[model samples]
Target chain A: MISPREILETINMISNENLDIRTVTLGISLRDCVHPDIEIASRQVYEKITRIACDLVKTGEEIERDFGIPIINKRIAVTPISIIGESSRGDMAQIALAMDRAAAELGVNFIGGYGALVHKGYTEGDRRLILSIPEVLARTKHVCASVNIATTKAGINMDAVAQMGFIIKQTAELTAESSSIGCAKLVVFANAPEDNPFMAGAFHGIGEPECVINVGVSGPGVVHSALKKLSPEADFSQVAELIKKTAFKITRMGQLVANEASRRLGIPFGVVDLSLAPTPVIGDSVAHILEQMGLEKCGTHGTTAALALLNDAVKKGGIMASSHVGGLSGAFIPVSEDAGMIDAVRCGALSLDKLEAMTCVCSVGLDMIPVPGDTSEHTISAIIADEAAIGVTNNKTTAVRIIPVQGKKAGDPVEFGGLLGGGVVMPVSNYSSSIFAQRGGRIPAPIHSLRN
Target chain B: MRAVITVIGTDKIGIIAGVSTILAEAGVNILDITQTTMQELFTMIMLVDISKAVVSFEHLSGRLSAKGDEMGLKIKIQHEDIFKSMHEI
Candidate 1:
């Protein structure tokens, strides 16, 4: 029999500390849904997703009831729509609507993979997908879009980066009535993970199985509570040990849930994404974990080092907990979705420059930041260029999901509501990067990539 | 299916009587139980086998929860695997 102390601890973590399985993402490959006729292809995409993911939400609920754990989201990730719609000749936005309808019918929070991969360069299909993003995102509420414009081996596609700047601005403009909410659903990535269970960057990669189950686990508050018990004099290694052990317990729960979900759904289990994803609610912010590490606030001088320790220890602890761990397995620092980060931004303790530096050691970069409304498209492009450069240089995945709130300036409070949260807009550099962005071409692969 | 049932609140009489009645009516057999007081609050942990429960797991859970609410206690029932997996490996 399990000891009472252990059982009580698990229950306390769930009821008080916000430990829960973040998402049970169903990855459905849409490679076979391609056709020259756009209508037929769209129908096939909708049918396949509905048929496969029909039980996703219901099953997740059942699991939640039995285990007494909250499964916050049941989402779907399909093959990148650019590849799925490559041979189709009509407006690709129709497919976006089809996916949105499927999500509505099946009752999933979001359906990702309205995306393209133009890391080296764009094909005609990729170009059309990129161009249609603003309208498609404006129209579809559940569909998400991501474009991979850079990779370590392929360097950066300066043209795609430049184009995305305009697309993001246009998305914001189209959804301006809703606080530029459309831009919140789109992410631009360098070295995007195919098996990511998180959004707005999740997509079922071409190499994945026809159908698989991936889980993303979250528990920043649990880590924060654990660290609060540590003595102030606890050294860095002790801190790391505590974090790693806490992460192990958390990921072990993730592994159990992933395996159970896979077994119940009769789908192959892919991986457990060991990420400390944050929510807008109090007590669940990753920044609080950093502050618990003795920093007065997040994004201080020692913030990067604190984040690096957390990210690496999480990965290290989680790796041994599960047999297969993949996806962006580290701490996420999305500004709008975290209360501590929102406070940090409002208090001026955190800056875009400092956030960018923090991303070098974290899982993803430049996530969920709302810039000034009048921020230029060229500057957005240059921002993507900088993030891409970091990913390429560091050989790690980095992404940008910045929203240029229409008619809003720095320090203005912006509310996106629900899980998206609200935060004050942060200012960006006024210096123009238009000329640099206009110089379009591919940035060649790094010299270190030749080792293969 | 086996599950862990926990009842916690102010240490007082009739808490055990109320919880045990609900479990007995649901045809659940308590396999093991331990009780203690922490921070001036009563905590009881019960390991129960519910495979032969007369009602659905959800229905039993709701009944137990409502009973807890009536008694001014925080009660929860979770599958045994959750505790084992987190603590064992």
Candidate 2:
């Protein structure tokens, strides 16, 4: 029999701490769903996704009940639509509609992969997909989109980056009535992972098998609570060690769920993403974890070093527990989705610049940020370019999911509701970057690409 | 096939008897039980073999939960592997 103490600890983590399996994402390949006629292609795409993911939610619920662990989301990701849409002659929005309809029918919360990959350059299919993203996102409720504009081997695609800046602006405007909610559903990436279980950045890479089950586990509250019991005089090394130990236990839960889900679904188990993803709920904030590390507040001077230690320790401990660790497997500091981060921003302890610097050491980049509605598209593009450069040079995954809420100014609040949460708009730099963004050519690949 | 059911609430008479009755009805055999009173709170951990349970896992959990609510307690039944995987190598 399991020890009584261990049973109580696990139960306490669930009932008190906000520990949960963030998502059980099923990746389905749509490479075989292509047809010359857009209508036929769309139908095949919808049918394939629906058939593959039909039991996803039910199975997730069953496991959640039996195991007594909350599985927050049952999601589906597919092969990037740009590849499958190459042979189709219909508008890209039609495919988005099909994906949306399939998601609704299958009862999944979000269906990712309505996206394009153009790290080096754009194919005709990639171009059409990128161009249709704004309208597609505005039209579909459950469909998520992502565009990869940079890779370590392929430099930055400035043209695509520039295009995305405008696309994000348009997406925001199109969904302005809903607090520019469309931008929240779209992600722009550098070195985007093909098997990421989290969104709005997940998409089944072409190299993945026909279908796979990937799990993303999150427990920032649990980590924070553990840290609270430690002595304040504990050094950074001690802090890192404690965090690593906590992360090992968290990742173990993910691996267990991934194996169970894979066995029950008869699909290959992909990877367990050990990300300390935070929610707006109190005690669940990654920023609070940083604060527990002796910082007066998040976004202060020592914040970056603290986050770096946290992110590194989390990965080190997680890798030892899981056979395969992938995806954005580190700390996520999305402004709106974390209560500590929101408070930090509201109290002037956190800023967009500080958040950008912190992203250099964490998982996702500049996530769930809301700037003034009047912020120029070129500025947003420049922000994406800056973040892309960081990822490209460092050879890591980074993404931007900023919402420029229309009719809102800095310090004003935009209520997106639900898990997206509400946040006060953070001010952006007033400086103009229109000239640099107007340069439409690719930034050449780094010298390291000459490895061959 | 085995689960750990935990009951936490204020100390009360007949709490163990009531829980044991529910498990017997579902054909779940109690393997071990540990009970303690810390301050005014009563915490009980029962390891039960549910391999021969007559009802579904969900149904058994629901019945136990309803019984717990009636007794002003919080009862949770979770698979044992959840603890083993977390606390054990």
Candidate 3:
């Protein structure tokens, strides 16, 4: 018999601590759906996703009701729409419409993989996909897009990097009335993982199966609650130890949920992403977990060291509990989506530069960060380049989802509502990187590439 | 299949009787049950085998919860595999 204490702890974690399955993304491959005719290809794409993911949301709800744990988002990630339209170079926007329509018909929250992988260089299809991103994202409600512009082995595609900066700026302009919200759904990556279950970066990699189920676990509140019991004088090592124990338990629940979702949906179980993803809900912020570690604020001087410890310990603890742990398996600090982060921005304790530094130690880079509307596209490219350099040189996945809010300035409030939350815009550097961005070529693979 | 049924709220008359009646009607056999008071609130944890229940898991859960509401308690029935997986190696 299970102890009442254990049962109560699980209930407390869910009811008060906000432990949950962040997403159970269904990854479906669309390679076989390609056709020379654009309408036929779109129809095939829609039919395949609708047919396969028809029960995804229902199954997720059933699991949620049966297990008594919240499953937040049921989403789908298909092969990058570029590949599906490569044969005809058809309007990728039409395919985006099809994906969004399918997501609506199936009642999934978001459909990802309206993207391309152009780390080294672009195939014609990748080019078409990249060019269509701004319009596609603006035209579709439920589609999330990503462009991987760099890799450790192949080096950074500076051309793609420059192009995406302009694309992001265009996306913001196209949806400026809505606080440039479309930019929130776009991600630019360096070494982006293929099996990531979270958006706006998740995509079905070419290596994945026909379809699979991957679950992302979130419990910053749980970690915060566990740490709340410790004495104020607990040492850094003791803090790390407690986080590991708590993380082990959190990942266990994630794996259980993942397997159950897989069994019910009849999709092969992919990895359980051992990530402590945060929500805008109070008591659920990853920043609050850092603050629970004794920091007054999340992005202060000691914040980098504290985040490094948190990120490493979470992976160490989670790897043991899960059979195959992948995805961005560490703390996510998406501004505007986390209450503590939003508060930190309001109090002027967190800034853009500090966030860039924090991303070096964390799983993802510069996520959901808002900047002045007048910020230049060249500067955005420079920001993506710096993050790409960090990811490529360190052999880790990093991404930038920076939003340059149109017609807004530093310290001005921007409201996006819902899970996106809202926060004031942060200042960007005055300097321009136009010339540097215009000098487009590949950043060759680093010295570490000679490893074999 | 097995499940963990938890009843939590203020202690009141017939709380146990109410939960037991629902289980009895649904053919759910209680494997273990324990009750305690924490912070002046009553908490009861019951481990039950629902494989022989006449109702589907969802229907049984809804019926138990509706009954719990009438009895002024918050009841949740979760599949037991969640606990076993999280607690046991």
Q: What interface RMSD does each of the candidate structures achieve?
A: 0.6, 1.0, 0.9
Model 3 residue A185 distance off true place after TM-score fit, in angstroms? 0.9
- Put the candidates in DockQ order, highest first: 1, 2, 3
lDDT of each: 0.94, 0.92, 0.91
Residues A196-301, candidate 3, lDDT per residue (tens digit)? 9999899999999999999999999999999999998999889999999999999999999898889988999989898989888999999998888889998888
Model 3: DockQ score: 0.82
Model 1, global lDDT: 0.94
List pairs with backbone clashes in candidate 3: none
TM-score of 2: 0.99
Better of 2 and 3 by lDDT: 2
With candidate 2 superimposed using the best TM-score fit, by how many Å does residue A31's alpha carbon deviate from the native?
Answer: 0.4
Error of 1 at A136 (Å): 0.8
lDDT of 3 at A72: 93
The alpha-carbon lDDT assigned to residue B80 of candidate 3 equals 90
Scored by lDDT, the top model is 1
For all the predictions, what are the DockQ values? Answer: 0.89, 0.84, 0.82
Distance (Å) between predicted and true CA of A317, model 3?
1.0
